[model samples]
Target: MAFRDLAMAMVYFSQTLIGTVGNVLLLYHCSCLHFTKSKLRPTDLILKHLLVANSLVILFRGVPETMAAFGLKDFLSDLGCKLVLYVHRVGRGVSIGSTCLLSVFQVITISPRNSRWTDLKLTAPEYVSIISILCWILHMLLNTIVLMYVTDRRCHKNITYRKEFEYCSTIRQQKSRTILHAALLFLPDALCVGLMLWTSSSMISILYRHKLRMQHVRKTNFTQRSSPETKATKTIILLVSTFVCFYSLSSIFQALFTLYNNPDRFLVNVAAVVTGGYPTVSPFLLIKHFPCISNLTDCVRNKKTYNVKRIMQLS
Candidate 1:
């Protein structure tokens, strides 16, 4: 394999390992702890489901790309290509849907009773799972069209377009398909963005209210960290920030590609890097934010310190 391929393989392999291990640890931590014990106060069931979806994204998308980067494309026959791309798309869509629901739930939970979305907290969980399932189903249907376009055409005897290639379907057919994909993606994307903004605004209002109450209690400029609501707000804020960063980078790169006369492979790779980068970083960020993970790290550090101290005493 070429050096470029080796480098790409390394990147994918590293991302897969990091995402898988981080999310697995997070899932384990969430499972072991009582939901009430955590400041964030996520339902145990919801956390488990979210982690399962994240795990699917890493395993389905990350692992396949890693294998392809390593030049292991022989197994990627027509059927394999369809299966891989389909599962990856499904997983990606599910991630977006689940995260969006999580944001909306946070917003609704934090919103006052008089707020328009206050009732959503009651209905959100039930519908959120349905929405997630529907996301996977919708994307699966949309990308099945991809199977028609994706073919294993040989190039220079040992080269091809990375196991799958999008052929130019009839112009009408292609436009229709692209439009369908775009439309489905736009709804969720818009909802997620709007909910993120609303949730963030609501969180600010809640903080302000708390600030006012604290002032009456003679606390000056103090922030609220003791409440379960505040912690959940922080988690949603971080999740939204991660989504915005990745999605924004992807949009910028895509726009650049369309605006420029000829988008280079380097920029294309950059686009791919951004698109595939979120899963790699998200779990790590969650771990950093979660106190349980912080405790685990602290425990490890303390153990190391104790071992070193014992060695020093012996010496």
Candidate 2:
């Protein structure tokens, strides 16, 4: 493989492995075991669903793209292309919705009793499920048109307008894509950003109150910052940060591809880099926020160091 391909493969493999492992552990912890005294809380359920969605995204996006990066021929046939792309898009939509719901839920859950958000926690979980179902249905219907338009081009052939292939959409359908793009891409993204901003602002206000309380108390407990509420805040911050980084990078590359009529080589490479960001960072984020995970990490690190010292002493 060329140096570029080798580098891309490393990135793709690492991200896929790390993201898969981290999300899988998170899923197992929340789903198969009781990590908290609270039984099957709304946030726990949301995390489980999010991990499933993320795992699907990694599979559909990471595998084929990695093959293509290594200069392989079209592994994804026409149906594969349509289905994989469909699942990736739908999974991403669900993830965005779930993250938004997580943020909103956290804000409400952590809000003071007098705050407006407390009223939302009572009903948010039920509505979040309804919204998830509606979102899946809507995204599936919107992407069905993709199968009608996309077909398998021959090996090593780039996509180009061909007269013989009636599979390429008519002018009317092309116009429809414009409308669908606005509906699917712009609307959902805007809503996510709005929700994130609201949640972040609320978190800031909470932090301000925390600081003020810390200042007034001369001998306050240092452990207050390490409480469950604080840990949850940190976890949400990590989630938001990862979401923004990955999605923003992908969106930028996609826009450049469309606007500049760039070569697929450049666009694909950018996409590969952007896509791996989530899986690569997710494990570290989980490790950082969870005390149990921190303890486990420390134990592993100390064990390795001790083994190394013993070997040196024997030498």
Candidate 3:
């Protein structure tokens, strides 16, 4: 294998490994919260959906990209290509939708008790399940278009196409059809991203106002630990910011690949990396906020301290 191919393989393998582990761990944590009859927050419910979507995105997209990086050819059959691409698109849509839901829900959760959104705040949790289900169903239906165009690379080896997905090749369509299909695919994602941006801005405004009020009341230079709402808002902001940044980079690379007659191999690899970046990094961002992880660490620390004290007394 060429050194570039080997290096790309290693990078993708690492990304897949880390993302899989993080998602699985966090999923297990969420499962524990559910099964243990713990008081599950609305955010927790949304997070469970996000983690599952992230896992799918990482596995379906990352594994194939990794294999392709290793210079694997004809590794997937025609059916395999369709299934992989379809699932990856659905997973990615769900991931974006779930993030948007999380942000909007947080904004509702933190709104003032007398605000116009009070009714929404009270009822948002109840609709999370329904909304999530609709998101899944919508994406699943929307991405069926993939099954029509995608085929095993071997089947299309002789045909020229503007886009290539390494293991899969798309059957080029008429310009009008391509534009219509592109619009169908882009609209839903654009809507979700727009909502996320609006909600994020609202959150920042709310946080700023709260901070100013606190400063006026305290009249002190020392910083106080933020309230739970503040902390949660900050986490969601960070998560959304990370997603937008990575998604933008991935979209740019994808656009270049589509427009260029013969895109460079390096562009494809970088796009894959950027595409998977949000999934690989999001779990770690959330893990820090999981109470169970913190509790687990504290238990281990106390156990170690107890063991050391016992040894010292015996000595």
lDDT values of the candidates?
0.64, 0.66, 0.86
Ranking by TM-score: 3, 2, 1
List residue ranges in candidate 2 displaced over 4 A.
Answer: 34-38, 126-128, 155-176, 222-224, 262-264, 288-315
User: Tens-digit lDDT track for model 1 on 1-315?
Assistant: 889878877877887788888888887677445422433344444555666767777787677666766766655555665566566666666666667667667777777788787667677666655665676676667556556544343323333223222211111134576567557656766676777777677777876886677766654335434566777677777777888889788878866753553466467556656766776676776675566676776545555666687789999
What TM-score would each prediction reach against the true structure?
0.73, 0.80, 0.90
Better of 1 and 2 by lDDT: 2
Between prediction 1 and prediction 3, which has the larger lDDT? Answer: 3
Lowest lDDT block of 10, candidate 3: 294-303
- Among these predictions, the greatest TM-score belongs to 3
Where in model 1 is the C-alpha error above 4 Å?
33-43, 73-75, 117-131, 155-173, 219-225, 254-264, 288-315
Instruction: Name model 3 segments beyond 4 Å from true.
Output: 156-162, 219-223, 295-315
Ranking by lDDT: 3, 2, 1
Q: Write candidate 3's Cα lDDT for 70-181 as tens digits.
A: 8887799999999998998999999999999999999998888888889997788899999999999999999999898888867845666645667777787787998898
